[model samples]
Target chain A: MKSADKHRKIIRAATKVFAKKGFFNARISDIAKEAKVADGTIYLYFKNKFDILISVFEQEIGKLIENILLLLENETDPSAQLEIFIQRHLEEMKKNRNLAEVIHIELRQTNKLIRDYRKNKFSEYLDIIAKIILQGQNEGKFRQDINPDIAKLMLFGTLDEISRLWGPGSEEKVTVEDISRQITAIFKHGMLH
Target chain B: MKSADKHRKIIRAATKVFAKKGFFNARISDIAKEAKVADGTIYLYFKNKFDILISVFEQEIGKLIENILLLLENETDPSAQLEIFIQRHLEEMKKNRNLAEVIHIELRQTNKLIRDYRKNKFSEYLDIIAKIILQGQNEGKFRQDINPDIAKLMLFGTLDEISRLWGPGSEEKVTVEDISRQITAIFKHGMLH
Candidate 1:
């Protein structure tokens, strides 16, 4: 296998291992075993288990950020852009339960390294929402009084809380589309009649 | 000291210890020392460290639930009740940063016992938000189309994400009141013009 392929294989395996056994319980050897690679070969690609965990987030979230930017480029209306963002976010989590579990659960690790990494990458993801809100305000479609910073938190927080229910072994009665629609409706238009 | 007072004192000390040291790193001896009691005295009030953690949540969150219930009783308008709810929730977190840290970070622990306890107590707290929405719909003040379950998640999730920024040693430029107002406005009136 090429170096790039081997690196990708290890990340994929780590996502599954971390999701299954959690970051603290998961061992580097376990990741190597799952990847069908020698334990020594694992060190060639990554420094340690913490390094692998951070790599998992960096790669997955980087892909998500890139995808959202590409997807949003085609839409002009901020409202529609916001809808697409919610739909895509929920859809991605629904399809990638392991990555979602790893991101949701492990992101809360109290370590300074993970916390700082999360702050930077997570803020970048959240900035997407803030930009949408700012665009809506500029277009005069959204309320001027609303703060983009707080609004972004509200939007991401809602999507995240909803995702917490989508853990493995749990059956969800609501479809991802249902969640996207419900969430978009609430944020686009206030709950007031 | 009275048994009840000693129990309360130990809980207070444990909150500081748990906040300072992540739950995994925190020892019963640390809690006992902080409380100025013998190490064995902790086991007298609780079964183990996990039991103490749960008790802290139960005692603190239980008080929050009780207070919100009492405070909301004075207001009949659902909108006003929601503003009050958001205000009180954020205020409690601001007043009790240690409790906030423990609840915010420790609640995400992957253990089944903590997870189940969190689901139950956290749901009870979130149900307060749902009940407000339900009351608003019944009063014909809020939109009838919204799902209280999803709305509750949005409200709690937003508050939670915001609270994550309020960890110790960090200075927040935005006041708790500013956050509550901003969040309440977005949820109550939304972003759309």
Candidate 2:
């Protein structure tokens, strides 16, 4: 396989390994075994275990950021754009449960070094929610006094909390639709009547 | 120290060890050393490693439930009750940061055994948020159509997400006031205005 294809292929394998063994327990050998690549081949595209983790996150969340940007670019209305963003996020998690588990549960295990590498590398993805909140405010669709940063946390926090609410047996308790609706409400309307 | 004092001391030590090293990484000897109790003294109160782990969780979250129940008895207004509950919850976590970390981050490493154990044991604390929503709906303060279980998750998950959001360097990004206010809006009136 070409380097790019080989890189994607390795990341796919690494994601599974990280999800299964967690970031702490997962070793590069397990990743190579799962990826069907030589151990050295893994090193060709990445530096180490943390690299594999970061590669996976950058790929998944990068795709999400790119798609959301494309959506916001095409859709001018702030409210519609915000709703679509959250719906897409929930659906994305649904499709990539392993990535969801890794992001939700595992990435947390990484120390300052791993997390800082991520903060710098993925600042764009991190700002997507902040950008949307800004868009809403600019369009006069959201409150003006709200700080974009806290607003960003609120947006992502609501979606994240909703995703988390769908725990092990959450399939039976609630559908993703239910969560999306609540996200729309809390995001648009400030909580009080 | 008396037996009760000794038991509390052991539980406190277990909380720190489990929080720092995680359940799998932490050993009884480490906890015993921290508690100033010999390893054998631990076996006297608890059966084994698993029992100690369970005891640690129970002692920590059990007090949380007790505090919640006590609040319910004294606080009548649903919204007021929620505000105070949030404040107390933050205070409680501040007091037991290690225990909070263990519950939020570490205990999730176990298999079905600990998961089932927690679900059975802390169902009341788990249900407190649901009860708040139900009370709000009955009082006509919250949306009449809200699902209490999902609502419960949204309430707890949002708070939990924000707490985690304050990870290492998220100090200035948000505050407890923002968390409490946003959660109140999301829970009481919901996302949609």
Go through the candidates in order and give each one's DockQ: 0.76, 0.35
Candidate topping lDDT: 1
Worst 10 residues of 1 chain A by lDDT: A104-113
lDDT of 1 by residue, A95-170 (tens): 8977787766677654445767877887899999999999999999999988898888788878877887687546
Kindly report which residue stretches of model 1 are placed more than 4 angstroms away from their true locations once superposed. Answer: A38-41
CA shift at A188, candidate 1, in angstroms?
1.3
Fnat for every candidate: 0.80, 0.30
Interface RMSD of each: 1.1, 3.4
Q: Residue A89 error for model 2, in Å?
A: 0.9
In order of appearance, the predictions have TM-scores of: 0.93, 0.84
- Candidate 2 chain B, poorest ten consecutive residues by summed lDDT: B184-193
DockQ (0 to 1) for model 2: 0.35
Task: Name the docking class for model 2.
Answer: acceptable
